[model samples]
Target: MRWSNWADTSSVCGIEVAEPAATAEVSALLREASEHGRRVRPIGAGHSFSAVARPVDLAVDLRRLCGVRVIADGGGRVRVGAGIVLGDLNAALAAHGLALPNLGDIDRQRLAGALATGTHGTGGRLHGLASAVTGLTLVTPDGQIHATAPGDGLFEAARISLGALGVVTEVELATVPAFRLRAEEGPEPLDAVLADVDAFVASADHAEFFWFPHTRVASTRRNHRVDDGGGRPLPRWQSHLSDHLLGNRAYELVNRVGAARPGWVPALNRLSAATLGRRTYTDASAQVFCSERSVRFAESEYALPRAAVVPALRDLRAWFDRTRAAVTFPLEVRFLAADDVWLSGAQGRATAYVACHQHVRGGFADVFAAFETIMAAYDGRPHWGKLHTVDAARLAELHPHFEDFLAVRERCDPARVLTNPHLERILGP
Candidate 1:
């Protein structure tokens, strides 16, 4: 069989695949794999651009083990199958008047995949999705089934273990009451936005911006929490036109053109930045948080101390000017509060996540490498699911609890059954 990630940046062939429908089945599969000395990897939605989910020996598909079970009424908590996609989970939670406190812009990632890779949304006061995991059900290599929650030795490490510890079959998440968001988005001078980026991040419930390479403008988005009934959503036609027709289809064409004519990228970027006119609308929290993303691109994101964002952007701008690299995609900037998850990017400090992207058809090696170099000066932590050259040795230096997390991985899967080349590279064998 063959498998490839969403961005087509990673793929594998001739791998044995298993679809496990229940926790017991997952345990059984793991036990069988261990007995035969066959490595096992839990495969999710493949949304990661990195090789994190690339299967080697056996790919354990968890999609069948999916559904949402309310643990308490009135949106307090819920036990969800790790395989449920975020979009589906959001709709399920909405049906129960509950919702995850934060969500990334793309909602196609499986719950486990998102948490495992430390996927996050933008908000200076918010932690990543993994922080919401109050409990988890893991199946270790020897078929051991362990149900862990806070205070349990394995909970924090397993939260963002890059599938190195074990297979996460289910997760118990703390949820918030379903809410709405009033979204305000517009174009602004890049320098001005960067000058007060911290203020902008702290000014709203959720905030982010995108800067087109070679352009002096940025498109900013600020979402504020509102009462459930207060939302005035965009008309269906307008929503489709903006998010689908223009955002994806047109954007795809634009990137293709830029790829074909690198010299035209600057003008194209300016046009792209200018077209992001002002807009405001209110919608359900999930609807406002997530958007349709069909154009595929490889990404490299780093989480730095919030204070380093402006200087990093300035350095990046300088690099672009010096090299005149024709990058077609916009650089996305988001913020997050410090978290305690052992392997999370924002584990110990307020963070500014800067993501650089290049269309698959364009050259990205030099640009991403340059971006990584700039981020390195600020002690940046690479997003585990994105492209980066950092290895476990350097990761150990960056994460204070890196060894501690390794201790948990040792205890859970000492033989390293739930691992791929990527896991070995980032977490060590």
Candidate 2:
């Protein structure tokens, strides 16, 4: 009954128990765990970068307890069980001509889990997945069920609690009409790209880029809203080639070769950047945001001031040039508007998301540390579910409402039964 994270990096303690099949079943399990003074953690597909779902005593798998429940008008919002995977939600919503407004790089996470971490996508004009949540039904430590929405103080705090406040049994998301996006993808020189970064960021409705470290090349992606006029979806075959073949399979092979021979990183990076070709497709926004990420890897991401992206990339490139840190994975850059969620990376100011990944076999300490050090200089906030070394005290300095968030957590789950070792490190006792 050992527990391993999505990346299979953590497996020191804990065991997987039965996954509850319904909301009542989850309520009962939480009550039982509370009576036994056992730490209960609900795991949703285990797709998080942090050990948010890692518990020493018990892990409750939520995949079975998932489906959409009509909450309001047929077109408004739907209540989703915590275990409902994003793919399932997407399919269901598509049937209803609705969808959560935004999504992240991948959509394998269960609804509650995704909400807990404030998982996001790049959109200066839009908000995170957590913001799409209109309400939440949580099983508190005392076994009482509390349902909260827009006006409740609990709503804001619980929406992105990193699984520290309580077990989110179900979530109600404000869905929008399933719309199409015209996606444009191509390569651009990193320097030339950043020279007009602000303009480029403001040009597209949703823009993101990935810079291949050690090379001057980058892949730029833009997804613009398209009129609902009809066109056949990209053929299933083409979708497979674009997502699975080129994005995952071929990309994995390149990273594997680069990881095996560190000295070949620069050449591989150039090839990787050069391989980026222009492609256009019209599909659901969620479909466009997600790409197949089959290759195993660990990630670290931080949110810096939007203005700091170019300088940060420059500093990182300088380090990669002088150091032996040979990383073949491209560095991702995304933008986000300010948010009020206490621990949200985009809190209080527009943010530039800087994310880095390394092959599972590739040791990441040095390069990650280098990135962290540089981000720290810019007062960056780490993504709640991503890798970081900061603790509550350091985090308190960054989050204006840190104490207020803790207060809400205390009132919502006084015993702190939902807190785990990882929570202890980040939120403290």
Give the winner by lDDT: 1
Query: lDDT at 400 for candidate 2?
Result: 85
Expressed as tens digits, the lDDT of each residue in 189-286 for candidate 1 is 99888888878998899999999989988899999999757658999998998899888899899999999999999999988887777889999999
RMSD of 2: 1.7
Weakest 10 consecutive residues of candidate 2 by summed lDDT:
9-18
**lDDT string, candidate 2, 229-348, tens digits:** 654467899888877887789988888888788999989888878877778888887788887788888889998889998888888888988994788788999998888776788888
TM-score of candidate 2 against the unseen true structure: 0.96
Give the clashing residue pairs of candidate 2, or none: none
What candidate 2 gets wrong by more than 4 Å, as runs, is: 13-16, 230-233
Best by TM-score: 1
Instruction: Go through the candidates in order and give the C-alpha RMSD of each one to the true structure.
Output: 1.1, 1.7
